[model samples]
Target chain A: MDTTSYNNPEQGNQEERLWNYIDGTATATEKTLIEKLIESNAEWKEKYRELLEVNQLLQASELEAPSMRFSKNVMEEISRVHIAPATKSYINKKIIWGLGFFFITMFIGFLIYGIGQMTFTGGEESTLTKNISKVDFSKFFNNTWVNAFMMINVVVGLFLLDMFLSNKRKEFRKQA
Target chain B: MSTGLNDNEIISKVLSGDHQAYAIIVNRYQNYVFTLTLRMIKSREDAEEVAQDVFIKAYKYLADFRGASKFTTWLYTIVNNTCITFLRKKRLDIQSLDNEHVFATADNIDSGMRANIVEQKSKLAMVNDAIGLLGSDDAQIITLFYKAEQSLEEIAEILGLETNTAKVRLHRARTRLKEKMETHYTEEVKNIYN
Candidate 1:
């Protein structure tokens, strides 16, 4: 328990052992070893007594009391502020999952439909332009589902763009 | 103010639109919260302000507390973070060099109070003064472990450290506190134990 030797390597190890023993976190072997050392070694016994006193002092320390009106002040402040509602009240997990399911299903469906329409003409002269030209644009657009999907895609794209631009404008205002 | 109701029950009532129920929660924990904030902040006035804010913030976010941990652990976490924020906003150099000076401000606040508490320096006053001499992190770990009686796991959760780290920190803080008592209050300690 010598403050002068606090930096000594041996002192540090001994303190750590004493702390582990005091906190009751030492293994059985460690506990036995510490007990033997404390019983036999005068230095270890002195350190043990000091640390035990420190532990007793800490345990007996009382919680500091605030002013008498503390709770009233806090309640008054609470009255002026907004309390957040429970998470379940505002955020619907089911709706989020439903939207996610809709998007994923649409993506997979589009992938399958795209693969089904691919005509693999295995010819040496096959070119990208020739394949694209063979696709009947009018027939593809003539499908009601495809037209409706395209309209939804445009609306979503525009909504995302508007959101992005508004965010940028807000950032600019903050900077300005 | 001792409402015989448990923390969870009070929380449930508060969430169900009974805001006055929060006063019970505040009353139950104000001393603990104030002690911890005062340990970190050093200034009783500012600590009181920060403690009030901690309660307000906790009430605002009450719905987010999910009963996964004890309410005291969650509340202490808020107290810890708010004090850190208050320290940062005050531009106190908590990281290095000026750390001692920042922590030493507690002496000005506590010295008079300690004097008036007892004519013969009591062990409790000596221990409190020794704690005031430690840096914020060390003081916080000691207070959480000793005063709050939080386990190593709960201390880790509150301080955002690993449990092992919290254990090490607690040991080191106790060591430093013992050293402080030895070096600073040697006469008082001897007089008290004599």
Candidate 2:
């Protein structure tokens, strides 16, 4: 509350020096000077005590801790990124295998359906020759019921195979 | 405090992909980081999320740490920056000493011990509300110096200010807090007398 000591040229400098000392920010010589001042002046001592009390109170206020999950969540996030690269290559390989299996199954089903159609007709050799000559082989293989049945079987079989493959993929993924 | 392996050793290990070494750094400063974040963010959920992000970012950029300062200082810098970013993105109002005056007057009738537990809780809520009224920089400096127990020099380093500047800011913040407290006490006294 006394501004004179902090404003007068000589006492003002000492007051500032004393403040730094009390705050633990003074250099060695300044600290020694302030110590001497405290020894000589009763007022400085009282000011020192008051400053310390304020500092202590400020320090006493507890700091709340952040959530307990902080460390775990951080580590988990970092590891998630780290593990991604390793699994990315595996995912790429799976995509290639899936595409290969899809095309191979389609080729096999086409061959099987073509052979079934050729065999169903009575003039087997002649039908085959005609089938080779006509691009529109549906005229010779115009049995709609048989064609429809074979198409249905092909779709059902592919569906079952897809389910089986997907199951296997899941198992493989789990193992990996 | 002198472990054979220094922060540099631990950081080098982390950069070489030895992630477990990171736990050492986290364990060392997690409390300080968490406390600072919690005080600033005010929500446990957001504080935890931000604190976690701070550490993870520190780890990712461990290589960028040139040993220009103490490891803890560097960590504080990151935490401070992260909290500021979060505050900005969320567009939270920076409360100043102005709000404390309002709180003090509004809750004047509920001062005595007879005010009950709920009233006590409201008092604390008002105090926190006052804190929330401080400007972002003021609130941060108050928390860093008072709550975190960081020296002015350490705070200066974290906030990238000169020591004198930090001291001035600290003085201003303390003055503001004291004023707010005085206003609250005066209001309560008036209500009691009335």
Candidate 3:
């Protein structure tokens, strides 16, 4: 009864449709149609049995095992090579939190020091607050050490930006 | 294989410097990895070598596995690629999945193993031989679907195929396996129906 070549276009279509049904990928209407065909058409019925048997046979086949010493050999091979420690092992959370706390404390201390330097002069009767923009920033900006720090910060920021952009470019290249 | 630890737990232990814990992973997945390698490479010796390379490669890069996908997905991806590389180095025709050279290698393995097991599991033996007759691509897809029990989506991820393409390939692979069974093992297939 299985005389037709599987490569025959019609036969391939039949097999594909039956496979979709077997794999549960077919729509409800297609499923009903296939069921009716299997019930009424001997060809569909035979094809269904063959395909189902193949599915069952595949599921039943045992996975091929390696030699009894396979794992031992792998473990032995691994022993000779150095494996790096896990990520959590090397990174110190305490140091990270300590740096974070120090930065926060320094930021707040600078804000408080700057605010303390501001003087609010007021007359009792008709006073608007003094123009804060007139407060001299030249004293802070003129320190060689401060200027050096700002330059260092700018250079470091640029370096970090370059690193980040390069990494993003590498990721884009990989995806493409 | 069950060291009372799941894959993630084992991975954590291995990462945390319990190098011995990797043995649990090796024991757990060796057969699976070996089977996949064998299906693709078609030689037990080369498959064994490649399977070992796969495990070692996975271990070296285990830290890179981010758990974005199942661990098996990552591991099988390594297996699939390693086999492809092995085939390429040998300069085998990978694109021609139905090549006689590929099928002949499978036949050599199946013919030797099929005899001793025939009395106990003839049906399984027949199916295994029929699968050996299939090209590496078809065999890998079938093994992934049935033996590994991977969903089509996982198969897609492992094979680097679109989900729809994976579905179609799986359908076509099974169809070809059916054709092989019908053509090569008609007697056993008849027995299955009876």
Clashing residue pairs, backbone N/CA/C < 3 A, model 2: B95-B132, B95-B133, B95-B134, B95-B135, B96-B133, B96-B134
Worst-scoring 10-residue span by lDDT in model 2 chain A: A81-90
DockQ score of each predicted structure, in the order shown: 0.43, 0.11, 0.30
Model 3's CAPRI class is acceptable
Candidate No. with top lDDT: 1
User: Candidate 3 residues B1-194, lDDT tens each?
Assistant: 45998899899888888999999889888889999998888889989999999999899888888786789999999999999999999998665366556446656776657444444657887888778778889999999988887888789889988679999888878877777777656666778876
Candidate 1 ranges with C-alpha deviation above 4 Å: A4-6, A88-176, B96-119, B191-194
Name the best candidate (by TM-score).
Answer: 1
List, residue by residue over B1-194, the lDDT tens digit for candidate 2.
23357888888777777887777777667777876786677677888888888988887667668775678778889998898899889987544324545455657755564355434543334344444555556767877876666778789879978668998777656545444444444343233223
Residues B1-194, candidate 1, lDDT per residue (tens digit)?
Answer: 34999999999999888999999999889999999998888789998999999999999999999897899999999998998899989998554223456336645667768456534757887798788788778888899998888989889989988679999888888877787777667666665444
lDDT of 2: 0.66
Ranked by lDDT, the better of candidates 1 and 3 is 1
lDDT, candidate 3, A111-156, per-residue tens: 5665565554434444344544555666656656555655756785
Off by over 4 Å in 3: A1-5, A84-176, B97-121
Stronger candidate by lDDT (1 vs 2): 1
TM-score of chain A of each: 0.51, 0.34, 0.46
